[model samples]
Target: MSNPLSEAEDSPLFITSLAKGLALLAAFGAGRPSMNLVEMAEVTGLNKSTVQRSAYTLEALGYIAKEPQSKRYRLTPKSLEIGSGYLQTSELIERANPYLHELNRSTRESCNLLEPSGTDMTYVSRFASHKQISIHVPLGQRLPMYCTSAGRAYLSALSPEEAAAIIARSRLVAYTQNTETDPSRLAKIVRKAHGDGFACSNEEYYVGDIAVGAAIVNAEGRPLGAVNIAVPFSRWTLKDALADLAPQLVNTARSISNAARGLKPLVSPATG
Candidate 1:
């Protein structure tokens, strides 16, 4: 596969410094909230000098702040303005918000809206159930396409070849004993999802969690993203989820897709 970084390096319009600064900002997350210059360089694959320059720029701009005691950099609340800007302006998210909340209310389970980001599905929006649940999937959490129901649902809307290419690029590591890493098997599951209009994961990505997902597509039948309802195993069985929640999940997805028909397509064409 061709390297996107190398391709960007060749582009005349690509801004290397801007990319470095953004990459540095992205390096801070739930796991690594703060980092020294060396840690930032390692996480972002940039040299120490570039990391230093990017950190300084970001600090000056109020996106990140350095701790005087430890000399580690952390993202400020101002950094959220970047993602907040997208949420404030996104039509798709706006349209899906009410529907996802309704699904959460009806199912009494956690619901999420996820979009394809590289080879993973990123949670763009979430609605938690009123009932107590052990798992908490925060917005922006990413899960591999091969083992996630939402990922399979999104992939099912693409051409078989396109979906296969993405699977080929994914690192098929088993997150649990039930995680299926076989490319061929995953392709078959995606095909089934396309036929059924919904996909399911049986504790594949996370233990004790089961989910059902359906793709939200444009008028052209291309996926813009997916809607998922996740439940803990203690509350619902696979058979119960399929019988009760699957229909509602598919219906909600269809309603969103219908609303999205008049909008511009959000999904990019297959690069390969």
Candidate 2:
């Protein structure tokens, strides 16, 4: 497949400087929250001078802030506006919020709305469980596609060829002892998810996190996102979760998908 960004860059309409500035901003994530000039250069693969210039520009724009004591640059509250802008405008998020809350309330587990991004799934919205023993996955966290129930649920909604292509492209690195890294085995899992109408992962992505998910499909049957319920190993077994929560999870995903079909097209389709 051709690179869309490369194609745009080759055209006269593309702005290289703007892209560089955005790349610098994206370099700061959950793992690397604060960074200095050297760290920014390494992460973005840009020269120190270029990183310095971008950092300065971001600071001036109030998107990033420099620590008074350490001089390390971190994203400011202003930077959150970018993601908040999307959430505020997203029809899918808007439509899914009520259902997500309901699912969380009924299941007493962390319920999440995830969208596929590259070879990972990004958590867009979550309703936390009130229970003391629960996994806390913050919004914007990314997990591997191959080992996550949400990712597999999205894959199960796609055509076999499309699903296989995505699996072929994934890194498939082992995140835990239970993570299935083999492409063939993972493909079989996806196939089963397609047959079962839902996907599940038992300590595949995280050691103690067990989750079940179903894809939210559009009118044309393409997946727009996924809804998942995550339970800790200490609280529930996989068999119990499937028996008790799977039906509700499937129902929630269907409701979200139906609501999503009535809304306008999303800014971008969920990708794998």
Candidate 3:
């Protein structure tokens, strides 16, 4: 599909109702919910006319609803239907969850099933290892593309140009003293992870914690996401984090890749 911003201002394929509707659904995020027409227009870059129609259609479809007092649109619990339907049929999640559990049980550390979200990463599924002292990251927590092992693993799976774009946009915060904020250095690190088939981060996203991850890609080599095992600095140093968990994480991710052999890329044009 041509870049809608550059191509026909209103190509029907580009103006696809499904695409526009899903874009409206995606417009809601962690900080921004209950969007007024302007916020929705800004996020979707669609005209108020288009956004208004999309919102009304979504509300009628039970995917979104208008707030009583605010008069802004918010996704309903029914909005989960789209994601839940995908999860229900995706062999990747069903096959990968057990391995996350096995790794967590063996390592006694939290493990996750990651999925790419543009340049960022998110957990589609996870099993906690620190049940007694577990860091409970919910199902859809987003992590930085630059500072997270899961993010880097997904980055490592991208084409050089794609990965470079992600790195360039990242502010590369020094989440901890050990974080790598330089773009060139981070590129080299991602390149190394690409070559090594794994990635690791020590207190880069979460301070005092370390994670090692590996990417799972489809036959086209497009990244499906990744899996990681995380342990705290108090429980293990960076060296120990890699030494102890790297092999298990790699094994689990490979298993997911093996199972996701025919996975298709989700090129949601409007959202992408």
Listed per candidate, the RMSD to the true structure in angstroms reads 1.5, 1.7, 3.8
Report the C-alpha lDDT of model 2 over 53-99, residue by residue, as the tens digit: 98899999999999999999999999988888877877899999999
lDDT of 1 at 177: 99
Candidate 2 least-lDDT 10 residues: 263-272
Q: What is the C-alpha lDDT profile of model 3 across 87-205, one tens digit per residue?
A: 67767788788777887788877888877765578788877765454355777778887888988988898887778877776667787788888998889999999998889998777
Q: Which pairs of residues clash in candidate 3, taking residues 3 or more apart in a chain or in different chains?
A: none
Q: What does the lDDT come to for candidate 2?
A: 0.87
Cα TM-score of candidate 3:
0.78
Candidates by lDDT, descending order: 1, 2, 3
- Ranked by lDDT, the better of candidates 2 and 3 is 2
Candidate 2: list runs displaced more than 4 Å. Answer: 263-272
Model 1: how far residue 86 lies from native, Å: 0.8
lDDT of 1 by residue, 32-134 (tens): 9999999999999999999999999999999999889998889999999998887788888999999998998888889899988888888999999779978
Candidate 1 accuracy as TM-score? 0.96
Global lDDT of each candidate = 0.89, 0.87, 0.80
Q: TM-scores, in order shown? A: 0.96, 0.95, 0.78
Most accurate candidate by lDDT? 1
Q: Please list all clashing residue pairs in model 2, or write none if there are none.
A: none
